[model samples]
Target: MILHAGVLGLLVGGTVIVALMLFGSLVGVRILRTWNPMSTSEEQLILERQTYLVSVLVAVALWIEIGSALLFIHTVDDLHELFVGAMCATGTLNANPVGWWVLAAKGAIVLLFPIWLAVNGLDQRSGSFPLVRLKYGLLLVLTPLAVADLSLQIAYFGGLQPDIITSCCGALFSESSDTVTGDLAAIPAVLAFPVFLAVSLLFLAAVGWARVSPRPISRIIAAVLSPVTLAVGVVAVISFVSVAYYELPTHHCPFDLFQSGSAFVGYPLMFSLVAAVVLAAMPGALLMVTQHPALRDVAAGSERRWLTGAAAAFTIFLVVAIWPLVFGNLAWESM
Candidate 1:
């Protein structure tokens, strides 16, 4: 009975998440179209309607995929165990040509949505402000987080050894045993020190750059980047420590709180927290800068509004995309 309830919960939750992702994609497409520079008025109207129709289809398809994944998850029992089960299921499905075709089609839809947005949404030049430049800057902020995430993956794959020396030796350390627990405990301390130092230096440099500029806009840019740098730094420190030192209990799943191996909770928490903090800080910083002595002197009324609106829109998008993870109960554990 408990198992059935758990399965149902997963199905409902996963469906909701898929719905959100699809909705976000649709919103992103609309944002892109609104900012599109080259479309004729008639063309824009037609595309807008088409975008809505495609969004509805995407939403329905996402719900179906969620149902499929949930069914698969329930059959497997363990979330981590599902990877192997999925592979076995894939093998069985491969025996049926029709099943293979169906799976392939679903896979294509899942993969294509993001690709479509990246290629089409980014290629066109649009609004007055430099969308590409802002996008690139966002990428820069995101890169470190990506790298840190990759490092966690590597650590997990390598196995949970506490000492860097032993971890390098490729031994599958036990989470329950003293030797393994000690090793896991040491990981966070080892990983965090260097990351924190580097991030702090970067923040100092940004602050210095902002101080040198006499304009409020420059200060505002600095302000926006500063908190982001700090948040990322905090996440990196937490992840570095958590991945290096934590150990899992022998009887329970490795994902449980006591487990040294599961980064599932820590990773998403850090990612969402950092993203949220940076986004929350962006608008106020932009507003303050626009009203500053340097910007006010050089810009006309129209230009100021354009710059402000562009900055606000970009920040809002960032916030909306990551808002679920931060405020909603959809962290790595849920995934």
Candidate 2:
């Protein structure tokens, strides 16, 4: 199983990403300590050139990090057949519990990498490069996370044993199970669906209003509601969306949506959700820099574009979630 093409790809890609980030962090530290746009000395010129190289290196590594995140899930799902009780990515992850940590690490990168890139983008838009210090500081923080991700992946793949009889998704997702996933699965669809629908609509309204109006309050509302909406959306998927997608109310394995039998619907379902969350959260994340006198005007101008993109992404998610509910034959009952 360790020799699988996808597994090899993930391991190699993770290693390269860590190396790039490590190099970038070394450069980042120097930049943090001595970066000054006003300095015209030879050392300052050298630092400027180094910053450009480090930025490109980190950007490439982060882009691969995003792709590797998705590939990690797909690889695990593909490996399920080797484990006796495995069903999907869930069971494969269960076979080697350390894989969960790998997933967590990858998820963190997925969430943070974009925010960093956005900050870098905002920094590049200015002549003075006002956000340089903040960007390098953030790179230093993220470098450790990249190292952890690789370490966890190595630990996970190294420990895999096909002989282990792991519990399948059915048991884990069933109400009889005592795990958090089980609790989410146990949520009554009738109740969960309404809450999900209400929150989704409200979030859309808030984000849409922000995009159109671009007021401080509207942006604040959208930013605040973005993560809340994503959390609720995940719960709703576990509670009922999966059920609707499968048309079997009792089958609630979210990973199964990625399989061919489901027409690979989970890709679009999750892609839109993540895109919506990331885009919607950008304005809020950028708020960290808005207080900087030099970045205030640039942040304000960029936020409008972010808001516009966020509204469109959120709409895509809403359409994808609602499509199955309306068109599919499954009708929610007590559970």
Top-lDDT structure, candidate number: 2
Cα displacement (angstroms), candidate 2, residue 155, comes to 0.4
lDDT of 1 by residue, 56-86 (tens): 4444544554354334322322323323222
- CA lDDT of each prediction against the hidden true structure: 0.37, 0.84
Worst 10 residues of 2 by lDDT: 210-219
- Per-candidate TM vs. native? 0.31, 0.95
Error of 1 at 152 (Å): 20
TM-score between model 2 and native: 0.95
Against the true structure, candidate 1 reaches a TM-score of 0.31
The most accurate candidate by TM-score is 2
